[model samples]
Target: MMKRITKLVMVIFLLTGISTVNGQDKYGTEPKKCQQNLSLFHESVKAKNFEGAYENWKWCFDNCPKASLYVYSDGIKIAENRYKTGDKTAAAKLINDIYTQRIKHFPKNLGKVYSDWAKSLIKIGATKDQVFEKLDTAFKADPTGMSIKNLANFFQEVTDRNKDTNVQKVFDTYDDVVEGVNNKIDKLTKQSDVINAKDSLGKTLTSKEVKKRKNIGINLTALGQVEGVLDRIISKVATCDRLIPLYQKNFEAHKTDSKWLRRAVSRLFSKECTEDALYPKMVEAWVTSDPSPKAYIFYAGILEKRGEKKKALEFRKKAIDLETDPYKKADYLYRIARTMYGSSAVSYARKALKHRPNMGKAYLLIARMYAKSANSCGTDEISKRMVYVAAVNKARRAKAVDPSITSKANGHIRSYSAQFPSKKILFVAGVKSGSRHKVGCWIGETVTVP
Candidate 1:
């Protein structure tokens, strides 16, 4: 009888401990009630019954905020539905609470959360400063996680606040935002290329792949839009007059800073302020401090500006050699080509194409070079005009390879095609429309007589 009583007491204690553990679970003091409400909330959401989901969602949110991420995600949907159905005040309050709770419970994607919160603030007619505060937090947390639209908004806020008093901040913000957007665009472009290739080959994509392709397109478009916005915002303050003075004042302080020197050199180069005395100083400092591929490229541009073509070519070659990324290598080659003319330019452009086969800009650059060389390449009307045909061919190839530049390539094609040899001239030259003709001089390309 004594052994039985002791064993029964031990069993009762264990049962009480189990109940305490269950009560203290993540689902709060009422674990069973929280779980039941969460299930009902999720089911109603799946059924698109926002009105029915609200009570259960509120219960889960109040009782078990840390239960699951879906608590916040589904809560957001419920709030949005409320907003759309004319419950703006209550919905906005709930959204604000949900964002706060989400950050408290799940802070991994804080950048996206902050950005979404900023957008919500905007929708609720919040002040620019308030919106900017959230956006600033988002960008600083994880710029890559922020939407392209939010990035644009963030930059605009920075510009509006600093454009006059702290222009350096504006430039810095512009660089950061543009770099982030470009990185995203580059990534999305690669994904888009793969999916497009598969689709072009008549391969059927899975539902997920199709959705991914659509999202890539949407993101690419948003990135492009943001780029335009950034350019427009910076153009006003990035002119040579403003940039020269700004860099001049800050050069002594930032001379040893490679990043500052690089930005100064890049901005000066872009604004055509290289003619100023400070440009070479920044370039020299950049190369000395960083000595990277981009630094070498900037130094090469300075050398070329000073008419030191041989030394410039060496530095450009050095830049190309230092770069390991195929895309960047191709870009360096293209940049070097842009500094040249005639056959040399075409040669470097072709080298770029070797590294990146779909580099349509290189082909377009070759087309422009060919068109400019038309008169120099041939003496006769027929031969001279045939150069335009070569240009047209390259432009068409550019359009075929890179959809991003189709409009620009089409414009080039239209202009070049107009300059083609007249039918009378072709007939007089005895060159049949379908017959192949070799272009003379540096081009050395075969073309159809048409």
Candidate 2:
């Protein structure tokens, strides 16, 4: 179905002549002349003959700016080669012209075009501010369409600006950009899930679909890297002391603005500032103004803090029940799990998995919990290290199922596997490497020792 839809969209583009190179009549160039230049440019580009491509590509750019996108595509290649060969000035101007023409021809795709433009500028050694301006324009125009690099870089630049006296801009950009990255990650993960679902049903993907899945994996991996970078950038600015005073100063003025209040309160909660007096007040105000599932979660936190365990559980359940999207419900449950102590975190994480089976991070979370409880799970060293085997099993499962976190999960598996009791120690205990061993305590999963 997805392939059919993709082909249909391609057909539409072809029908509209958007995919043709010879249809540059609107640029006032003769069709035969345009075709000749386009053909020559493509042939040269295909042969890696940037110098040979340059003259023909230049004719298309000068006389037929509205030609097919490949004109710009080949032009960028030529420009990059020229720039690397020391003609930086000429190359920069031509690359900039390519972007301008592409935008003029396809104004609707400004976000992505501008992001590409910003990336080109970075390649040419453009100043940070120049790159930032282009990325900022791209983000504001269409954040979800922007690349992971742009999204993360924009936040970093905004943080730089915040230090120069626009602190609120940093907060605003972080909120918006992080949300955009999450949306993109969710979108790509769903694409992979579709392919994985088919595979699970014994329907192997065609070669084309396999390629598509690989691309999705590549994109998810890139997004995961940017997410870590963004977190590191924000961590420097989001300290509890810095956050509390900043929120305290604006709390009264923005109390009625639920969006603002929620952002403030959520930031505070994430930074573990819930003990502050302002946290409960903001939670109450958020519930009064919006009553969203997120707001209910904050209110639940307030209840938990007051030692009202039963009431907190009820509000938390209400929050989870109010959420209709399985992914989001799982996210709320995951958060609840993060906030909980002892064995209950694993239970909440399991509940999250019940709602969304492909949430590999949930498995990772469970593994971490089991590892944390290893010392108390058994009295003997051998029995305790058996918990590492269970932890490693979950991490391995996560890597097998989730492409987005495959790298991280594999790292966990390696680290935990190393911590497992040596084969010599296992042999002394009458255990074989391939034999099954039950990990007692809250983690009842059986794992094969290595």
Candidate 3:
């Protein structure tokens, strides 16, 4: 009888423990009730029944504001439905409330939340300055969280508002957004390369991989469009004439600011404003401030201009020697390639690839060099066109290894393929299309005859 009583007690204890565990929740919501409400609202959302989900979702939201991130997410859907029904004021308020609660509960998502808030404000026809304030906050908090459209809009707004007084701000924001865009493209390209590698040697990709590739391609195209828009908007104020004076005026204030100096020098150099005295001054300031490889590269350019060939070469070599990061080293090498001629450019490009195999731009550069030297690379017409074949091969390899430059590689492929030796030429040379032919001269790359 006593043993039976002990077993009963143990069963009661187990049941009590289970009840206690089941009752507690992350946000201290009554588990049974919250679960019922959350499930009902989630199902309604899935069913597109915002009306059906509204009451339960609101109840869960008010009762357990910290229940889950989905509470706020679902709230947006509910609010949107409210707006569609002709209650814009209430909808806007509710949307704001949802964002506020989301930030309160999930502070780590602050950056993205602010960007979403800014976008929402923009959609509702907020004033340019108001929208700019939110966007600036978002960018300052985390530029990476912003979408390409938002970033472009942000820069446009800044330009519109402060075009006369603060051109530097416009320039700085442009640089930031461009870097962010390129970084995003690089990431997407690397992802594509991985997915592409999974396909068989002679077979098609799986359905899942195909879908993934399509999504990446769509995103890259969208980003490219946004970049075009950004350039157009910034071009109004970033003209060489405007840039030179504006930079000259502020040079003194920002001379010690290495980041600012580097950007200023790079911009001036890209605009071919190097003939201006300000360009050399900025470059010298940059070197004095940082003395990094980037600064040294600029200084080297000045030396070359002054006809100090030996000094320029030494400075260039010093920059390469000082750069420790493989990626940075590769970038320096690629820059050197740009300034070089003939086979020297190809050699430096090849060296850059050694340090960073994913530098697709380097491959494109090498291909261009080969195409330019087609007449010099071979003694005969067929042999000269074979250099185009070599260029096309390099371009194809670039696309295979880095999807970020796939469009560029495809362009090179098209241009070179059109210039390829006709079948008649191949026949006359007694070379088959698939047979390898050596491209003599400085470019020793073997290419398939076409």
Candidate 4:
């Protein structure tokens, strides 16, 4: 009986020991399966199931970093693809092998993978130091890519930020507290604060420093960012104010393409485009980069806004000359003849008909000009009547050609007819009875103050 009890106790110990061993190995058995999964990972990649490939690769790297080729090679390739497609998760998973457990295994290519992560951080607006920290981590793991030049460039930015920068002040302050370690013991921490970090600002600062640092500020201001800053404050600011010149200054520096400039201009004009100081040079740059007839048209409008009508008309004519189609050119001529002075109206109207024979407005312009010219003759009754009759006939023809002009042409006909009723000088000479200008033809009685 004692032998039987001893055997039972021994049997109980054996079962308990087996149970304890399994409990100790609870998380340890994962890697063997991870390696088996990694063996199938390349097939997943070949099958174009990138998610499966990444998942398996991630598991293998974390669980079994010794799976030599998969951790460094396949993981990096997928991470790059992740970066491009904006698949942050996929990208993180792909690089997680190099970043996490397997970094110590392959030290050389590991640093590059961290550099790649820093690049990703930059796209998302990480600060310079944050980027450098990751960059340093990569260098620590694999120092191959940690170039002397990169260190120098980054360190230069920090030093420059602390210097007496005469760049445009943002008028806003950003508080930054930086801690520096004084010695190699890595024990002592140095602390400092900086104020009013003058990043690219909208202030069109007129500094003696302006000429030198303008390019640096402009460089920081992207083609898009420059456009945005100019948009917000262009209206509330003055034209001949200090800022006017910087628009021209920066325009000269840009290697702008037509599409970007077009969008930028459209954005600027959507706000206070009529501001005298801004539009002229803005339009100038548009023409400078790409001189289309449309560019000249916009420039002409800007000139007109600045009360430079003569310059405006010159650009308008340039637009007309640049026009390829004769019909459009005729329209341009009509605009010039009607709105501007001299005896060109009759001739331009005739030319317009010659180019576009069915043009109705041409007949109206010619008739009006002739009627105007005729009535101006003081004593020539026959010529005046003849011109009046000619004017009436042409006005009638315009009415016949296009009914849309009849209402307008009739008003012109009535006004000219009443203005020169007799076309004869009134007998009284010293002073005209009514001073010549009349305010007749009221539909309602006028109000008089008592």
Q: Which predicted model would earn the best lDDT?
A: 1
What would the TM-score be for candidate 1 when compared with the true structure? 0.76
- In candidate 4, residue 346 scores what lDDT? 71
lDDT of 4 by residue, 54-101 (tens): 777767666666656666666666566666677676555445445554
TM-score of 3: 0.81
lDDT scores in order: 0.86, 0.83, 0.82, 0.52
Models ranked on TM-score: 2, 3, 1, 4
Query: What's the distance in Å from true for residue 447, model 4?
Result: 42
Runs in model 2 with CA error above 4 Å? 1-29, 144-152, 406-411
lDDT, residue 420, candidate 4 = 44
Superposition TM-score, candidate 4 onto the true structure: 0.29
User: Pick by TM-score: which candidate is best?
Assistant: 2
Instruction: Tell me the tens digit of each residue's lDDT in model 3 across 1-450.
Output: 999999999999999988776557453557678878988998899898998899999988888777777798788888778877857887888887888788888786555678888877766666777777878888887766677678777777888878898888888887887777777776786677677556635557879889998888777766555556777897778778998989988888998999999888887877677888888888899999999997888898898899998998898889999999777788888998988888899899999988877688899999999999999988999889899988998898887666556767888999999999998888877878888889989899787776
- lDDT by residue (1-450, candidate 1, tens digit) is 999999999999999999888666678888888889999999999999998999999988998898889899899888888887967888888888999999998988788899988988887777888888999999888776788778877887788888889999989887787677667767776787788779889999999999998777666555556656677768888899899888888888899998888777877877788888888988998899899998888889888888998999899989999899988898899988988899989999999998876678899999999999999998899989999999999999986665556667888999999999989988887878988888999889899988
**Ten-residue region with minimum lDDT total, candidate 2:** 19-28
* Alpha carbon lDDT at 371, candidate 1: 99
Error of 2 at 384 (Å): 1.3
